[model samples]
Target: MKLDLTIPSLGPCHVDSPLKLSKQKGISTFNYSDDTQKILYDTSLKNFEACLAKGEAPLAFEKAGPREKIYFDPSKTKAAIVTCGGLCPGINNVIRGLVMGLYYRYGVNNTIGIKYGYEGFIPSFGHPFVELTPRNVADIHKSGGTILGSSRGKQNVSEVVDTLDRHNINILFAIGGDGTLRGVQAIVEEIERRGLKIAVAGIPKTIDNDINFIEKSFGFETAFTTANPIIRDAHNEAKGAYNGIAIVKLMGRDSGFIAVNAALSMPDVNFVIIPEMDFELEGENGLLAAIQRRLAKTKHALVVVAEGAGQFLFNNELGTDASGNIKYHDIGIFLKDKIVEHFKKQNMPATVKYIDPSYIIRSAPANASDSVFCGKLALNAVHGAMAGKTGFVVGRWNNQFIHLPIPVAVKERMKIDLQGELWWNVLEATGQPMEMKS
Candidate 1:
């Protein structure tokens, strides 16, 4: 069980005098140089530069600065903000930033907070809209969770639209993950069908970071940072016993961004399993056998598995949530049970520590990085909506804010690129056996 000692070293990857980007006249300008811009975009750069020629180019993410654009008369606009899906860090930051952006920056004093996501619009739920002001939402960013709250259910598009029209909402900011964005899509379709003049803007809120086309969703860094301590605790617990195994399961039902990042953050992990990769349970190359091999070499071993990992071994009969997302099998508990059984069958003694810190990570407030990200996304969403841009979500494309069409955003789920640099980093960090040979 000797681990690979010759880890690949990352070479210097820096450039002098990087592209200078500036915001002017509601457009982000990248002072293009022949060398970098050509290689960066290839032929696609032509389309972007063409847009810039037409006075439309988004800010490059490398610049990472703020810009101001006034698309609507603040005095006559009414914007509504609603959050759905499960809680994640920085939800409140987005809410606060959106409120502040609309009320103060745009002079749009009439901002409404829809309680409990789209459910707030259903008449039977009795979840009415609350007026959002700078005074009321000033300190909301200091805490976690949404001040407007959230829920998950397939809402009636007609009812939701009626509610929006009844309230005379001009700009609607829907914040949630994939399912939430899908719901917004339906609402937008209804608006178009009915010939309404409402604008819909979405804030991508996938804690799992599974939504496609967005580089990195908000709260992902916060989740990874928060999970570091939890995994460290597991490592310590495993080390305390004679032959110990620590198996920690994290959120990421469809992708393994959280699990892989968490594993990279901790060096004690001996194995990292994600949903994108397949692993067995009983054979020599199986997860249990891997643990046995690691235990033979060391007194303690740490394993990290994404919730969606090893799902193929579980039963096919799955239950769907209110949003129709299938609930994943409890990989953490299942691994714990199998480990105990495997050791018992061999008459070997071992201690297994199981840790699930999902709720804690999701419930915490945004870290400093996420706070800034949420602020920028919220601000840009406001700008896009007021400019009559509908059916789009504000997302970070190559680091700059791009008003990603909701259809494009929800077209596919973003998964960890196994062959990409991030996964390579994870593999190097864990030093896990790439091919668990029998």
Candidate 2:
């Protein structure tokens, strides 16, 4: 599928950037990013060859960084930041990064933090806005969760824009996942309809790392890292008793990155289940049969299942949540009961342990790697906004940060390619069958 990588802008940038860097061509010095700099959407040689053979320009995204020229004047620019959706490891790191980048890097001192997601924008919510500064946000990176707080739900677009206008906010840095980014798009449309020059920038903030086009979203590495030890502990738990089985339920709602990665990292995981693949609980080739076989061989087993996995087993509809996402049934608990019943029916003794570390992993502070990534994402977002870029989200693609339009970024979620090498590696690591269907 062809993607439109064009980024929308308020107008031409004219103000000079406050950051000083050498721009000499022959000298070895740091240079500002040119508007013409772009990163290819598809870097594969096969795709490049086919595009060249067809005489079509390959799709590309605008490289994200600081531009020599900016549109908003530092002294007059009033910036606002709001974090929405669920909590992740590095929300505070991102918030602090934005505040520091705006205050010190660009001399943009007028910054405010929205209290509770989009609800802060609605006056009736009665949420107070906090003034952001380098001093106040100095140690926020040391903590987990967003200091500004977060929520899941849609707010009125017109009312949100009205709040921005009332506060004379020129730049808005919205940090959230799919739902929050969609909200940002609506606010952008409202601003455009009213001919406002407010620049909206999104920082993808999902622990699932399901945002489209981004190679890795912030807080993902931290999540899997935090989950690594839990999987190992589960492995030990399984190995401790006779016919022991340990099930670890991780935080991948739509994608299985966390489950697969954590299982791969721990090696002792016998089965890795995700939303992308389907499996049955009964029959010869079903998960239960496989577990029985595993216990017969090793006398112990470990399973890692994503929260969104095995959702087809549920009969009653749980409906959607406040963010319009389907409320998934507890697959981990379901699998535990099914396994216990199946073993009992077979007249076999089994010890079962279920661990759900979703909240613990999500609320922990970001590790060293994710902390650095969050800071970079935040700074790049500020750079784009100051350069007049709007309706765009900052993401890293092919190891480089780039500007992605909100519409395109939220078009679809990034899922594990079951046919690709990652899944192959996962299968190799876990020694799980490619198909667990009857």
Candidate 3:
């Protein structure tokens, strides 16, 4: 095939010195260095053609139904509760509620407690069980530590499943924080792999109050309730004793929940410092300046700070145990020491009083709201399982006890609904600052 070629873009007569035109044989081919057409795309049938094709008897089944049905056995009703991580105050209340709900209300008699958390549930460690009954948990609502006790951290998923199978407990309730919930996920996945059926539910119970899905965990209410009176009484004492400032630090890692609550309880509080807020700690002169300013106007002022507030204290926080766990020391003590040190340095005339409320907050008796929340959360977990619902953490949303799915909660990060602006407004009205310094 003989063909004539034209370089249309460039002028025919004008050529660069380095350019050359070569002539070929009669069977002329535009012999480029490389030639390959890799793709020849195609389109699917149109409406008419597709309609003409057979619509019925298209055969393929990707999967079949399960060989064995996993229906709940009414006669085989059993439950196991495990508490992992540090002991939160309302562990007993949740356990008590679960037992009571399962036995008296639902007639589930064979409830056993998984002793010492998921760590003890491992086959490597001998499986320890607690025989649960209404009588056993009679006064547990007022109790502190888990009656079954608890261990910290997690175990392998297979190990958890093996332990679950060993105990033959159909329903497992995990009581702790985020770590405990993650462990539950692992165990659930493994149980699915084994084709075994078990209902896994997580009850939020962290002093940190960082877990998602649950807006408020069981013990946090108790903690605040326990701290409320001390805050009131402490503020009163500090006010009566001196015309100076008294700082009370509560436990909260970064969230202002605890400090915010304490500050609300003592509205005359001078300043509230939580990790979520600003992280600046000042000397006595600044605090004293504010206190004296308030005292000049009013009497004495109280301040609430979070436990995780680092370096805001005069005394170094106490170290943890041999296991390398950090024990939260008194935030109040830190404030008190700083105030005392500031007074010594400035030689101020006002009597400075420093009091740590860490011990008092932990020892706080269970409050009405907290006890109710804890009990409700336990019942929610059980019923949620009986209904075969999962990934939801029990909480009070819109003044009703409900399940907040973990997927939805994680995407939202268990945060305060700033968009609503109502909670924030109420907080500000209660004398809780969104941010506080020193």
Query: What's each prediction's TM-score?
Result: 0.86, 0.99, 0.71
- The CA lDDT of each predicted structure is 0.79, 0.94, 0.59
What tens digits encode model 2's per-residue C-alpha lDDT throughout 205-258?
Answer: 999999999999999999999999999999999999999999999999999999
Residue 302's lDDT within candidate 1 is 91
Candidate closest to the true structure, highest TM-score: 2
| Residue-by-residue lDDT tens digits, candidate 1, 1-438 | 111111111122222211123434344553322211211212376777876798854333121122232335567789999999999999989989999877765578899899998899999999878988899989998898889989998889999999999989888999999999999889988998898878888899978888876888999999989999989999999999988988888999889999988888877778888899866787878777878877888888998888888888887757898999888789889889989999999999999889888999998999999999999999877755655667878777655556566776787798977789988887788777665545
Predict model 1's lDDT versus the native: 0.79
lDDT tens digits, residue span 1-438, model 3? 111111011012111211122334255732111011111111233533543484522211111111111234435667888888767777888898888877764467888888878767775677567788999889977766767877765567787788778778778888867666666666767777786667777777777566653456667766766667767776786678556566666777646576666566556565666554334346333444555556666566677767765544436656764224456655566666665775577665555555566655654545777787777777766655544444445565434454544433334234334434634643574444443344
lDDT order, best first, reads 2, 1, 3
Sort by TM-score, top down from the best: 2, 1, 3
Residue pairs clashing, model 1: 61-399, 61-400, 210-414
Off by over 4 Å in 1: 1-71, 436-438
